[model samples]
Target chain A: MKTTTVFTIGRQFGSGGRSVGRRLAEKLEIPFYDRELIALAAKESGLSETLFENADEKATSSLFYSMVMGTYPLGGGAIAGRSEMPLNDQLFLIQSKTIHALAEKGSCVIVGRCADYVLRDLPNVLNIFIHARMPERIKRAIENYGEDEKKAESVCIKKDKQRANFYNYYSDRKWDQSETYDLTLDSGVLGLEGSVDLIIAYDEMFRKTEGKKRMVST
Target chain B: MKTTTVFTIGRQFGSGGRSVGRRLAEKLEIPFYDRELIALAAKESGLSETLFENADEKATSSLFYSMVMGTYPLGGGAIAGRSEMPLNDQLFLIQSKTIHALAEKGSCVIVGRCADYVLRDLPNVLNIFIHARMPERIKRAIENYGEDEKKAESVCIKKDKQRANFYNYYSDRKWDQSETYDLTLDSGVLGLEGSVDLIIAYDEMFRKTEGKKRMVST
Candidate 1:
């Protein structure tokens, strides 16, 4: 094998990001995780699987808003118990741990759950963000989410906001910023297959370059 | 020569976007415009060059804020004359016209000034957004903008906000959003030369594909 390259994808809703990730993993013969990671986190955290799903890519935004407005009690200070801590935070920690564990296990593709931020310290990981122009996403939503155009766009926008908020809250870096990821591709232009091919090519080029660097150092 | 390819780049502040645009223009042997567009707009609008520079990528945000707050003089009605309209709107129109005129003239690279939004309707246009990670952008600011690290980050963030607001207010599409462009690359990942080369390759690929499409259609 050339190398075990890990990939983390951050993407806009309805952009066929998960589809591309799955296809890439298949083409690359690697494990793929999207909702599957949520399952693993649930298993790791010993929490109800439903809890993770409910909080998937979305924290308790209303609770946070109310707390900011001083309308909701925060239960306790910063030392709040695990049970007392916000559900979203608990979900994030378990998912973060699961992401690290997966990376340690082997090279694979992990989608969302802020895996880019969680595994950023690793040297072998490539973080990619996938998005399309709104019209394309709206078209994709019709196909993927089976929703009409207007509803799809609104849903897409809302989901992007929630995902951004989730990533921003948990990660030190802002979400979807160009620098946050190693590569940012508009799936709208390249299309899903092209995006997967680009990533694979990038991985090959990166590993070859790294191989040369290691040889020179040695 | 292959068909002319126009590129409009929308980028995050401190991402070395302008430099990349310049380098790409050189590599592609095409004309490049950044601040030059502002001068053209100033000429077109018969507005002071200083006004365009002052409002460059930042419409009179304070004026917009005041208008939003119902405090600014809105010139009596919605259909205000060019003389009574906000300085930002006049500048945008002139630049919009300039962008279209440039497209009609020949292929070129345009940076900022909402060029992507301005040229969105064109067939042979590639809208690329260049962004780097914050740490990388800070380093770039020191080298490119000659600012201290702390100030570089702050200025970068502030500039990004202003650019976003300027874009959001003027264009129907939102700024920095992935769907807003055809290609979004991380200059941090590919670096200047690599990014330019990538775009060239994409342009070639796009042209070949378009040739196939036109043949099939005919």
Candidate 2:
């Protein structure tokens, strides 16, 4: 059965979250959004793609600092009343709007960009956090991403910190905390394919439960 | 195939964790231990069952305070070198030993008492954390456990804090954190039966992956 559920994935770096999202979208025959969000946000906001890419997963204070120091440009956007906002804030707003629009359109998988928080009001959104052991994440960074072996562990740590700060700053909930999501999966233990399978199982169960709830309410 | 996998559950009060553990154990046809551990520890250590039940989930400092105030007794046990230890510590040690012994015997579902941390050295242990939202938990507390309607929420919160403190004080890892457990389930979202089904799915997947790893190693 085709589900109208939207899956929002928050993941640690090198935890195969992006890959899982992509594969899940494929299996579910739904659209997948990850880096594609940046381009979509850029298109919607009339901002440069490079600006959104650089602003991605960056905490607001750093952008504010750069804006204060006159090192960053307040890019022109088509949207009104957002010109004076920090670039990070502007990007986040546009991205959140884009995420809402995407979810409203249909069932899809969106990774990162605080889509969970953005679509918090939607009943069909399933927020998921994917994580792995530090050593396994570091190994994935080095082996899969082809990072310098010496810097892989640090890189993973840095990326996760950035994501955490970004998510925590934008959303009321803390990133990677199980309470913040509908489900949290350990990609390290489940493996990427296993994680996807588990998610599929959960999605089916979620749909069935939701169906029952709706039936009772009606 | 009859697989040997010990399931250790950490849970919030009123989250149906004990029920899930009992049902999972029955389905797996393995032994289930919750309050039963108190009796076992009492039997093994020659300490009164009341001591074990009272000392259960109480942090060490409170027991230490009682000892310093000359209110608590230093119960004699069959084990040596534990007479001088705080009652909480003694109970913890004895309970942990009981957990290790239970795990060594075969596959079993052990609930609470920091079994995940106690059996950290075991390869076939699956650490799970079960939780539910406050409203559902409070409802369950009042309806199932017959907690006072006005006091159910506070009771759930208080019990969870005690469990968290007991776990955090003894284990290197923090309780209720997703990373601490192999799987974390929201009974609030999954429902009790759904949670059990999901866990069964995960256990099967876990065993298959472990079997593959063993084959590769050999």
Which number leads on DockQ?
2
Give the interface RMSD values of the models in order.
7.9, 6.2
On a 0 to 1 TM-score scale, where does candidate 2 land against the true structure? 0.90
The CAPRI-style docking tier of model 1 reads incorrect
Model 2 residue A117 distance off true place after TM-score fit, in angstroms:
1.6
lDDT of 1 by residue, A1-218 (tens): 24677899998998788888999999989999999999998887666788779789886676664553463333343223555556577668878889899998878999998887787667677788887666777878898788876688899889899999888888777787665666777775656887787778777656643321111110
Q: Give the range of the ten consecutive residues with the poorest summed lDDT in model 1 chain B.
A: B209-218
User: For model 1, which pairs clash?
Assistant: A132-B179, A133-B179, A179-B132, A179-B133
lDDT of 1 by residue, B40-150 (tens): 877876657886787688765665645534634333443345545665676678778988999778889999888877776666777888877677777778987889866
Interface RMSD (Å) of candidate 2: 6.2
For each candidate in turn, the TM-score is 0.78, 0.90
In model 1, state the lDDT of residue A74. 32
Q: Report residue A66 deviation for candidate 2 (angstroms).
A: 7.6
True contacts kept of each: 0.28, 0.41
Stretches of candidate 1 above 4 Å error? A42-51, A60-88, A147-154, A177-179, A208-218, B40-51, B61-81, B148-150, B208-218
